[model samples]
Target: MTSVDLHLEEQSMVVEEDEFREGEVPKRKNKKKRSHADLGEDAEKRGICYLSRIPPHMNPSHIRQILSRFGDIHRIYLVPEDPNIQVHREQASGFRGKEFSEGWVEFSKRSVAKRVANLLNGEQIGGKKRSSFYYDIWNIKYLRKFKWDDLTSEIANKNRIREQKLNMEISAAKRERDFYLSKVEQSRALNFMQERRKKKQKTVGAESDGTEEPKVIRQFPQNRPVADGGAQTKTKLSKDILAGVFGGGS
Candidate 1:
């Protein structure tokens, strides 16, 4: 083939690639814009309903089956019964199944949600007599100006608070247990010291009683006085001697 013809074919291929890219760009942009518009419309039409009391053994799937007859359901969230209460009921009745206390259902259209709430509110759940929830009543209400994001945010905030409280309780329990253990240790140490001191005293008393003897104190007698006549004769003898020595008392 000629070089000029080959060059022309290369140019044509480049132009075609550019045109393809240009076409793809606008298609992608249009898709993004359409998605955004659809999302806005969906948000405006979305509605939420509240169920005050959920019948026992009624799960989200069961609720969807029943409510789907009226309109399309977007989402279902049923708050489970308290674990403590469920345990008590299970023991008393010997029936074990997942139970919900309350629930919230999201519908694709606001009008359908409102209609379902009105129709089902205060109405008996009529079904086969053998159905567990046949006699249960619906306590549904349409929530105005409420959104799914609001429910999710509220649930997240509650979970955060519950986690904080559980952490605080665990810390408090640990502190109390540590304090109790410390007190027990102190009491044990004090008792040990007292026992050692008592033993030391007993040992010292035994040594003193065995090695030492009792001390004795001495006593003396008293002297008596002479008679009066013996005292006078002695004085007369002393006076005669003194007269002989001095040759006379003129």
Candidate 2:
């Protein structure tokens, strides 16, 4: 082919390649756009409800099964009773099971959460006559504008504070133990030195020509009695009379 025709063919091939690339770009963009729209739909508004008091021995699974009757439950969190209280109760009653103090439930929709809280609050949990929780009452409330993240943050903060307090108590106990041990060591050292001094004194006494040295007894001075003023005056008068007679004779 001539040079002009060859150059024209090359330009047409380049144009076709560019058109193909533009078509693929729009397809990828469409896919990304659709993915974003699907995400927006999945992130529906969720709501949380608070249970001030959970029935005794009710676990998270039990709570979900009961509350799920009203709406779709997304999540459930039940706070177990304090370990110390649980241990005491178990020992007294001979009943061993997990008990929950409080709880939070998240529903798929806000309206469902609100309706469940309204209907169940202060109502009796009616079930089979033989069921344990049949007579238990509900103490639930719908928490407005509350989020699961907020609850998680609050729990984390409490745990942090508790750990810090425990660390402080342990360190204080260790310090007290160390101080007591040091004092005991000091007393032992003092006793050891006193015993050594006694032994040394005995050894020195024994080495003195096989005869024990005489120990100097310590004597406290006795207080003298004071004479009355009349006695002192009589003695002075007698002494003056004797001196006058002797001087007159001389």
Clash-forming residue pairs, model 1: none
Candidate 2: stretches off by over 4 Å? 1-44, 197-250
Return the TM-score for each candidate structure.
0.68, 0.62
The 0-to-1 C-alpha lDDT of every candidate, in the order given, reads 0.80, 0.76
lDDT of 1 by residue, 175-242 (tens): 99999999999999999999999999999999888587767887888676677777666644576678
The candidate scoring highest on TM-score is 1
Could you tell me the TM-score of candidate 2? Answer: 0.62
Residues 1-250 of candidate 2 have per-residue lDDT tens digits of: 5443344346434434544655623112234446766644533577899999987766665676578789877667666688998999899998898787887888988899999999999999886667788899989999998876677777767778978999999999999999999999999999999999999998888788657668889999988766676566663547668879788434
- Over the full model, what C-alpha lDDT does candidate 2 score relative to the true structure? 0.76
Give the number of the best model, judged by lDDT.
Answer: 1
Error of 2 at 99 (Å): 2.3
